[model samples]
Target: MCENAAVTSTDGQQSPPPAPVVPLTDAWLVIPLFNEAQVVRGVIEEARRVFPLVVAVDDGSRDDSAAQAAAGGAVVVRHPLNLGQGAALQTGITYVLERTDANFVVTFDADGQHSVADAAAMVQAARDEDLAFVLGSRFLQGPSPVGWLKRLVLKTAAVAASHTTGMHLTDAHNGLRVIRRDAAARLDLRQNRMAHASEIIRQLGATGLPWREFPVHIAYTDYSKGKGQSLWNSINILVDLLFS
Candidate 1:
């Protein structure tokens, strides 16, 4: 549902119509924010155009990420100390479930890598198909434009996660997902780091609920690239997955 509104000025001049209001009020966006003060505000503001309810869980950022997120029309939840992405995600999810009546929850990255259109599509698909979960995959449509080494690591991780979770996935660490309210309530993410990616897949797979992977494009802009995870973090995730 979309609606455009216009207003008339005092001098009887018609003002330009505002952007169409998207009717995705039943879904809430959960953004795990750390030191993303530069881009988090823009991301939240853009996403709010479609999904009005957005909650940014600030994971003890040393910057003004919380303030920026609030300014962008998102409800900012702060963690006094850096608890990592997984913890932030869990906090956001819990907030949505406890404080709102949202039927769906969308986990979106705060670095502007995720597209709001894709997120909305995933939610619509889930509602149409009656699925409990809709996970994002970068390699579902074709090969993603990732570096050779990073591609290798991601593929290897996907294979390992598939074997462990018994869910065939092309991209194991994509951070865009839609979870129904009941499904979101069932999630209990304990891994407080990048390892939570694999853990989430495993837990969601264990739910035995209907789920599908949607192809999503990740924008690797100069700013996002600069804030991307480090090689050591990737290595640690692999190690955690292999052992845990």
Candidate 2:
């Protein structure tokens, strides 16, 4: 279960002395940025427009991604060294738990694939279902823009995970997800790189955390497309699954 579970309201009000926690109006948006100095600012700006408290984790970028995110109104947490995506996410999550009062934690990619509106929708959906985890799916509603081979790999992995976990999710690798603080606390992120996506599915399967998937926009811009994992990355992910 998530250790950070607490009701928060948008208004900065609490119940009483020894204060009752007003449902958190604050949601911690954790964006793990690598060398994405170009797009990080826009992502942070969009996040700020929706969620007042957005935390951008700079994973030892060589560029000004950290400073740019800070300038764009995100609370930036910089790692002394590049530990990888999982570590960056963990850093941001832990910061939110310690520094601010947040009712939920939502993870987004620094790449421009995710939309701020979709993110806010994910949070609303979480509130309605009271679920611990929710994943974003690009394939659920229509054709995905990714190349056919990539789509094939993604679909296969999702199907395999669904069969393995008995949870029929169409998209398991999507980075856009909302986690209840308690559920997040329970996740042990061992994978340092791309495999973290698969690791999350495995952990949720083992923990039986209530989970669901919602369709979200994944804008495959020229920049995002260029930075996307190679078809070989999917192969490596599969190898990791077999061995893991």
Candidate 3:
């Protein structure tokens, strides 16, 4: 949780990281799709512009999510049954680690809530800092618009997670993240549902992997809002955390 200013990439003295000379050939963007027919293709197409490899995990969606993702030129992987987002992410990461020569992987949202520019920054930051994981935080420096009650609940959950993980995170549930191959190898996420977020943080805290957070914008459109977690689901996440 503490920033080690002394360990930064320094050519001579304290300095910024050099430009990304290292090609991102093995770095893949993973988008877990669950009936996101309207925006899945668009997201994959845009992501392909920044990343050469894009892996979409179709989490047993009833709709044509897998077809649309394939049409968008992403390597589509399908689960015979509807697994949760966490399971889908694990499946996609495993696919890259085992199927390709990927050294890094990013878990991204398929609902068009995430931005490509921010994701690029995160990937660069992870490389520069030699970090295991880099998370995107809406509270970093952007205009995060959420309802008062929803905001309060989310904030409370984040605080509780920070206490549990000792990471002092600004946003705990953000889906935008980058994980290096080494870190991905270390991660063993058990939670298959929303609680997977907490599971990730807990594991990172236990392992004490070098982690950082960057600013990113999360657009809450009417469609995104409709697809977002309900209040009851949030409560269920808390309950799961308490028991597990």
Top candidate on TM-score is 1
Model 2 Cα lDDT, one tens digit per residue, 74-151: 888888899989888878888878787677888998877887778788888888988888889998787777777777
**lDDT leader:** 1
Each model's C-alpha lDDT?
0.90, 0.80, 0.82
Alpha carbon deviation, residue 64, candidate 3 (Å):
0.4
User: Per-residue CA lDDT of candidate 1, range 7-120, in tens?
Assistant: 779999978788665669999999999999998899998999899899999999999999999999999999999998999999999999999999999999999889999999
Off by over 4 Å in 1: 1-21, 228-233
Error of 1 at 72 (Å): 0.4
Runs in model 2 deviating more than 4 A are 1-24, 228-236, 242-244
Scored against the true structure, residue 142 in model 2 reaches a CA lDDT of 77
Sort by TM-score, best first.
1, 3, 2
Ranking by lDDT: 1, 3, 2
Residues 28-137 of candidate 3: C-alpha lDDT, one tens digit per residue: 99888899998889888878877868999999999999999999999999999988988998888898888887778899989888988888888889888888889888
Output the lDDT of residue 1, model 2. 32
Candidate 1's C-alpha lDDT? Answer: 0.90
Clashing pairs in 3: none
Q: Lowest-scoring 10 consecutive residues by lDDT in candidate 3?
A: 1-10
Each candidate structure's TM-score, on Cα atoms with residue i matched to residue i, is: 0.89, 0.84, 0.85
- Candidate 1, residue 127: the lDDT equals 95
